[model samples]
Target: MIDADDVRRIALSLPETVEKEAWRMPTFRVAGRMYLTVPDDETSIAVRCPRHEREELMAAEPEKFWVPPHEASSAWVRVRLAALEDLAELRDVVVDSWRQAAPDRLREAHPALVPGAEAAGGR
Candidate 1:
């Protein structure tokens, strides 16, 4: 099963990534944009998600996902690894987050990733 370490590892795996302080927690970013963040207690991690999917994800899996109190209302969902059985899903979440946070020009330049290249080899 995935855990805090798994979350940290996955976030740091993104290309041209770096970790820094955000909301008093460790946050991962690409080109200065946030993609993933470890919450204060480290029990969960928040990832950037499509605004459309926010409610569905939370309603469908309240124990696994939630919307944080004070940021991007429908664009971020905090996920608890203890409630997630599939690591692939977690990877997809993080990848999507990465894409959202990546610079628009960088995304335009990386055609392969635009279609989610990371999903192909993810576990």
Candidate 2:
């Protein structure tokens, strides 16, 4: 099962990522903007999720995805670590969040890592 250590390893392995403590929790940032946060006790991880897609994701997998009341109005979603299927899925989620938070320059520089970069015709 995915856990805090798994989150730490995956998140920190990404490009330009840094781990910092905020609100007594572990936060992963890309170019200084927060992309992922692992709350105390580490049952789950919160990451950048487009608001338009959040509800559908939650509906699709309630056990895996959720919205913390405080974050309901924002473009973020919490994912239960235990619900993840494997490291590949975790990497995908983390990469997507990282792409969403990364600057244009960073994204461009790391097109191979950003989801849909090649699909979107980005080289």
lDDT of 2 by residue, 21-80 (tens): 999999999889999999868999999999989999999999999998988999999999
lDDT of each: 0.76, 0.87
Q: Say which candidate scores most in TM-score.
A: 2
Candidate 1, residue 87: how far the Cα is off, in Å: 2.4
Error of 2 at 108 (Å): 0.8
Worst 10-residue lDDT window, candidate 2 = 114-123
lDDT string for model 1 (7-105, tens) is: 677777767779998668888999988888888777788888777788888888899888767765557888887787776667767777888888877
Candidate 2 TM-score versus the reference: 0.90
Q: Which stretches of candidate 1 lie over 4 Å from their true place?
A: 72-74, 108-110, 114-123
Best by lDDT: 2
